[model samples]
Target: MTEGRDDRGVAQTGSNARKVFIKTYGCQMNVYDSQRMGDALGSDGYQPTETMEDADLILLNTCHIREKAAEKIYSELGRIRLLKAERANEGRELRVGVAGCVAQAEGHEIIARAPAVDLVIGPQTYHRLPQALAKVARGERVVDIDHAVEDKFDHLPASQAGQIRGRGVAAFLTVQEGCDKFCTFCVVPYTRGAEVSRPLAQILEEARRLVAAGVREITLLGQNVNAWESSDAQGRAIGLGGLVRQLAEIPNLLRLRYTTSHPRDMDDALIAAHRDLPALMPYLHLPVQSGSDRILKAMNRRHTAADYLRLLDRIRAARPDIALSGDFIVGFPGETDADFEDTLTLIREVGYASAFSFKYSPRPGTPGATMEGHVDEGVKDERLQHLQALLRDQQAAFARAQVGRRMPVLIEKHGRHPGQMIGRSPFLIPVVLPASAGAIGAVAEVRIESVRPNSLMAEGAEAMPEAMRLRA
Candidate 1:
C-alpha cells in the first residue's frame, strides 16, 4: 500500500496554513464528494483557496459521464502545467492532483500522460488523500485506485461553513454513495463502486447538525436515492421512508427532498413517505432514460414504459399535487422511430414538470459502448431537439399554472437585481422577488405574479397564510 502524502511541505498551522483549490466538475454527487474532501483536508490543516494561482495544492475533481469529459480534464491539466512551471521557476513547488471518476477510469494513464500531477486519487480512495500527499512529498508519483471498503465520511470533519453562498435556507446532505443499478449507459457503478449507504444514525446526526446550522430545507442526495437501505443500531433494516420520517422529527427542518431515483426502486415505503410526511416535498426526479421496452432492455434498465407509468400513477395517487421530473435519452443504440415515439408518449402521459433530455453518447468500459446498431449523430441530434421541444412546452405549462398561487419561498440570497432576493419554492422552482437582504434564510409567503421560461416573478407578503408555511 502506497501511503499518500504531500512532500511539498510540512502541514501548516495557524495563519500559515497551506491553501488547496479543488475544482469540481459534473453532478451534485461530485459537489458532495468535493465538500467531504475539503472537510478531510481541513482536518489535516489544509485550508481551501479560491484562486489556483495562490494555492499550494490544486485538485481537479472530474466527471467521466460525457464523451469528452476526460479530454476536458487533459486540457485543464495542460493549462495547469504552465502555472506549475511558473511556480517552479520561482523556487516554489505546487502539488497537482486529479480526483473523481476520471481518475478512477484512467488510473495510471493520467500520470503517464500528465507528469506534472503529483497524485491521482479516485473517488473511492479520497479518504487516503493525506497519505497520497505524503508519497508525493517523497518524490513518488502516487496513484491510489483501490476500491476497498472504507467509511470516508468518518474521516470528514464537521462542516464549519453555514448557508453556502450565504443562502442559509437550504442545503444538500448526502446520505448515500455509489449505485448498484448498473444502467448500461451510466459509468457510476464502475467509478463509484457498490451501493454503500451511511448508517441511519450518522445521517440523522448530520441532518440535525445541518438544521441547527440554519439549514431549513434539506435535499437528501444519492445516485439512486430511493434504493437507500441501512441497518439501525439494533441491526434492523430501514429504508428511505423511515429515514425521512426520522429526519422530519428534527426541529426547524422545514422541508425534505431526495433525488435521482430509479423507477425500479420506487418501493412502497418511499411512496408512503410522499403521502404521510408533510415535510417531504411533493416532487420526484425519476430517470426513465428511455421509454421503449426494447431500448430500456438494451440499456439494462429492467423497467418497461408501462412499469414506469404505473410507478408514476402510484406516486401521483399518494400526492396529487406532486410535480415530476425525468431523464430521457434520445437515439440510443438500436432505437427506432417507434422507440422514440414511445418516449414522447411516455412524457405526454406523465406530464412532467421538467425533464433533462440528452442524445446518447457512449462511455468507455460501459456495456452500451460495445453494443451494436449505434444511431447516427444527426438522427440523435434530431430526436434530442424533438424531445426538448415537447419538454419545454410541458414545463412552460407547469410554470404557468403556478401563476397567482401562493407558495412558501425560502429566501436564499439576493438575486441579480438590487433589493431582490431569490429562493426556491417547495417544488424547487426558482422564485425572484423584491425584498430586503434581511429576509435571507427565512421562509416568506410569495405570490407568483408571473412566470418566465425558467423562473417565477413573485412578491413578498406582510403576512402569510398558515397553511402555506412549512413547519418542521
Candidate 2:
C-alpha cells in the first residue's frame, strides 16, 4: 500500500522514491511536455532513471505525426509487456503508462489491446499524473484523455530548472499548445486540440525559473508558435513578438529561438522581432507545405506561392542576415509533374539554408486520408529522394559559407574526440571545437576551419587569428 495523498493531491511515497523512465519521441514541444511530466511526478516521490531495467514505472511519451505511429507504439509495448512479466517473476511490479498524442488518439484501443498498460493520459491531462498513478495503484486501469477544464499549466509544479538544464545547456520551453490551422496532413488539431497560448505571466515565470536554474538559452515552442498571443502584465493583448521582447528582458538568457511557424500568421511585429531583438537567434523554421497554387489550395493552405515569396521578402527586409528553414511535403494528393517542378523552382528561388522534406502521409480523419489521387509509393519515394538531394546541396553550401568566418557558438556538449566539444552556430549548425565540459553554456568566439555536410569544424578564435584564415 502507498502513503495517502496530501492536500495538493500529490501521491505520497510508501517508503522509498520510485524511478520513472520516459522515452520521448516527436517535436520539441513533446520534449518540453516530457520534462513537465517528470516535474509533475517529482512531487509524487518519483525520480527519473535513464535505464529501463532499473525503473519502477515506464512511460512512453509518443508522437502521432508520421505514418504507422500507432503500430510503432504497439511494437514497443509488446517488448515492455514481456519486461513486465519478467519483473513480476522477480516479485517486482512494473507499471506501464502511455502519454502524449498517440495516447490521446488511441486511448481505449491501447488499453484494450495491451492490458499490461496501467494508464493512458493525454498530452493535456498529464498534469494530473500523480492522481492517475494513485488510481492505478488501486488496481483501476485509467485512461484519461479528456481535455482538462482547469488550466494544466497552472497545476504543474515549478520545474527543477537547474536539474533539467544539467542535462543540456539549452532547453525547450513551450509557451503555446495545439493548432487552429487544421492542415490536411496534420493530426495536431485532432490530437493536441485547439490552439491556446499560455498567459504572459506563466511564460515569463517559467523562463525566469529556467534562467535561475543555469539555462543560458531557450527555444520557445508551439505547433504554430508565431500564432501565440497573450496579454501583458497590464492586460493589453499582444502577439508572440511582444512575448519574445519580454523574454529577452531576462538578464541571463543568452540566446532565444522559436520554431514551426506558419506563413499566414507571420505578423508584422513578429517579423520585426527578428531584426530588433539581439538575443533572438537569426533562424526561422517556416513551413510552406507546397509551392503549386493548385496544390496549396487543395491542401487548404490559403497562401499562394506569390504570397509566400512576398512574406519572405518582407522578413528579409526586416532582418537581412536571417537564415531560413522550411517544411515541405512532396507527394501530396493530386500533385502533378508540374506541381513538383514548381516546388523545385521555389527551392532554387528561396535558396534555403536547410529544410525538412518528407513524402506525404495521409493522417487518419484528416481530409487528405479520404482524398482521391494518392500518389503511388514509387513516385513518392522518387520525389522524396530528389527533394532531399536538393536540400542537402543547399545545406552543404550554407555550411561551406561559414568556413573562415569568426562565429559565436553556444557550446552544448562534449564531442566524439577527447579534446573536442560541440555547440551550435546561430544558423543552428552543430560545430565541433577544441574545448572541455567547462565550455558548455558559454557562447565563445570560434573560427570555422572546415565544413562537413552535417557539422562544422572550428578552432578557438584566439588560436586562429583573422589574418591567418581563408576568406570565403
Candidate 3:
C-alpha cells in the first residue's frame, strides 16, 4: 500500500512511506534500471515522488557513455547539494545518492567531490540499495561499486502491479546488460562489465507481468541488445531473434522492439525474425561509429564500412520497409579530410531515416584517448555540422515520403491540446491526431496527412470502431 499525502499534495512526515525522487540520465536501459531501483527500495517502505523537494531520498541514476554525460552528473549534484542543505536547515531529513555508470566508474571520487552524497551504488550493485541506505542511516557514507557475486536481477523484487500500470502502455525491459566488444572510444565494457544475458525464463516471466499490467509495447534493452543470447526450456541455445519470436507469443503485446545494436551481432537468425515477426516494429538503431576503414580499424569495431553496408543490404532485403538509423562519430584520433568524406559518402549511400552524429570526445581509459594525431576541435565541429545537416535532410525526406501513407499507430498519451493525442508509428515516428482519452492505449490505423518538423500529422481515422482498435 502507498502512503497518504496531505491536502497540499506533499507527503506527510509522519507517513510510514518515504518518498524517493530519481533523476535518470541516458538510455532506455537507465530508465528500466531506475524502475527496478524503485522496486528494490519499495521493500524498505519508499515510494516514488516526482518532485525532488518532497523526497526523503534523491537518486541520480547517471550514464557515463560520453565525457559530457559523466560531467553533467556532477553539475546536477551541485544543484542537489543546495537542496539537501536547505532541507537539513528546516529539520527535515533528505538523503542524496548516486547510481549507475558514473558511480561505477568513479565511486570514491564522487563521494569525495560531492560531500552531499550519502550513498553511491553502481549499476551492478543497486539491488543492495536497501542495505546501503541502512548504512547511510548509521551516519556513514556508503560506496558499493563491486561486481556482486549474486545475480542482481534474481534479487530484485517484481514491481508492484500498480507501479507497472502507472508506467504507461509502452515500457522497456532489459534482457541483456554490459558489453564485451571493448571498442576503443567506448567505456561501457569497463563500467558495465562483461556481457551477460538474463535467463530466458526470467525474461518471459517479466514480459508476461508487463503484458498483464496493460503494457502494449515492450522494447528489449541492453548495452548491446542484439547480442543477447540464452537457452530455451529444452536447453537449446537461442539468440535475440529467438527471444523476439517467443515474446511475440505474449497475448496483447502489440509491438516489440530492441535498440542500440552492434553491427557484428546482426546475425542471420535475427534478420529472419525481422522478416517473420509482425509484432516487431520496422525500425532499428544500429551504431556504426565511423565509415572510414582506417578509423574503424583504429577504433577496433572489427567491422569495415563495406561489411556494415552489406549487412544493411541483407536486413533491408528481409524487411523492405525497415527504417534505418545509425550512430556516427567525427574527428577520432588521426581522422583526416578524406576520412570525414568517407563518412559522408557512407551516410549518403545508406540514406538514414534518422541518425545520431557527435563530435568525438576522448574518454579516459579508452584506447582512442592516447592515440596519435587527434583532430582539432574546429575541424570536429565543422564535420559534425556537415554530417548533421545531411542527416536532417534525410530525416525530412523520410517524413515527407510517409505523407499519404496509411499505417498503424500506437496511441501513447494525450497531446497538449484537449482533443489532440500522440502515438508512435511503426517506424517509431510520433504521429499526432485527434483522439479521445479512452483511445490512449489502443492501436489505430490513421492516414498520414502532413509532416511536422519533428512529427507526422494524421487524420481521417479518429473515430476508431471497437473492432478496428486493439485496446490494452
Candidate 4:
C-alpha cells in the first residue's frame, strides 16, 4: 500500500515548537483522518514534519484490512522504540502514538507489546488529540479507544487556508463513515462501527470551505460511499445522487468523484446521476469479492454473481463510456476449482479496465478464520498469480485503448525531469508530458502519445475536432 503524506514538503519547525510526523496507512479514509488529526494537533501549535528524526512526536494511522497488519505495526514500533532510547541518550525527548483501526482493535495490546508507545487513540477519538497530547506531556501513558458519542467533525478545528493551499488542487471530503453490511470476511464493521451519514448542510459547508481554499476537485470518501443518505431543507430524503448534484453546483469545483461503492446500494437515482452529471467523472470502483454464488453467500455479500453483472449492465447502460474497476479475492474459504473458474468467467464477461485482486487472509476474530475447507497457502498463492496475470492483461488493454485519445488532465505536480509535468486523467490514470511549471493546478488538454504499465505518455493537445467531440 502507498503511504499518504502532506503535499507540502518538510514544514519549517521554527514557528511551531512541536513537530509531528504522521505515517498513514490503509484506505483514502485513513488519509482523510490523518489530515484531520494534523489539523486537530495544529490547535496545540504542532506542525507537520516529513522526517521522523525531526519530530517531537510520531503517530501511525494504521489499517487492519490486510493480513498480519498488527504484526507489521509491532515491527515498526520496535524500530521506533530504539529511536526513542537513542533520543533519550542524546538528552532529547520523543513520544510515539498509534491511531486508526489497528489502534481501535488492538488497543492496550499495542502499549503492552511496545512500552515505548506513549498514547493510543482510535479513529473515533482523533478529535481529542490535543487533550491526549496534554496528558502525555505530564509523564502519562494514555490509551483512549472508546467510541466517541459526538461527531468528530464537530470538534475538529477547520483547517487553515494556507494548509489547504499547500495540499494542491485535489482533496478528499468524507461524507459517510462505517459499514452496516456485516460481510463475514471483513473487519470494517467492528473497527469503524455501524453506518453513519453526515448531515447534508454539514457536508455543503465543508465543500464550500474546500473550494474557497483553491481546491478544484473533490472526491467524497466512505466505506460504502454510494450508501450515503441524508435529508434536504424541505425534509425530502436524498441519497448520494442528490448529494453529488448539490456539490456540482459549488463554483470553481471542476471535477467530482466518489469511491468504494457497494452493489447492494447502486440505486436508480445514483445511476441517473452518472448519466446526467458531467462534473461527476465516468469511473466507478464496485467490488464483488467472488463470482460464485455459493462463495458469495459464504462471505455474506448478499448479492450474487448474476446480480453484480446485472448491476453493471444498468450502470453501463446509463453511461456507455464509463470505465469500470473492481475488487476480487482468491482462495476464499470453501472455494473449489469450479468456483475459481466461475470468477474467471465473470471477469471475461465484464472485462475490467483495472482491478485489485488479493489472496484472502482471515482476521483472528472474523468468522472466515474458523470456517472449514481452508485453502492451502500454496494453492492460494498459485490462484492469486493466475488471477493477477489476467487482470494485468486487461489493464494493459485498457491503457492501449486510451492511446491517441485527447482528454482533459488535471496538472497536479512537477515531473521527475525538468520541463515536464504530471497529472491525472478522468479515469485516475497518471499522465506525464513536457510542460512549464505554470501549468500546475490548471486543467490542460493532452493527446495520449503512448502507454506505460501504470501511466500514459502524453503531449500538448492539437487541433482535433473529432477527438474533442468523442471525449467524455
Model 4 segments more than 4 A misplaced: 1-16, 436-438, 460-472
Top lDDT prediction, candidate number: 3
**Residue-level error in angstroms, candidate 2, position 86:** 0.8
Off by over 4 Å in 1: 1-15, 161-167, 436-438, 460-472
lDDT per residue as tens, model 2, 295-404: 99998888999999999999999999889899999889999989999999888889899898889998888999999999998999999999889988888888888899
Report lDDT (CA) for all predictions. Answer: 0.84, 0.86, 0.89, 0.87
Could you tell me every candidate's TM-score relative to the true structure?
0.92, 0.93, 0.94, 0.93
* Preferred candidate (TM-score higher): 1 or 4: 4
RMSD of 3: 5.0
Find the candidate with the highest TM-score and give its number. 3
Candidate 1 per-residue C-alpha lDDT over 64-110 given as tens digits, one digit per residue, 9 for 90 to 100: 98779999999999999999999999999899999999999999999
Residue pairs clashing, model 3: none
* 348-380 per-residue lDDT for model 4 (tens digits): 899888899999999878899899999999999
| Ten contiguous residues with the weakest lDDT in model 4 | 1-10
The C-alpha local distance difference test score for the whole of candidate 3 amounts to: 0.89
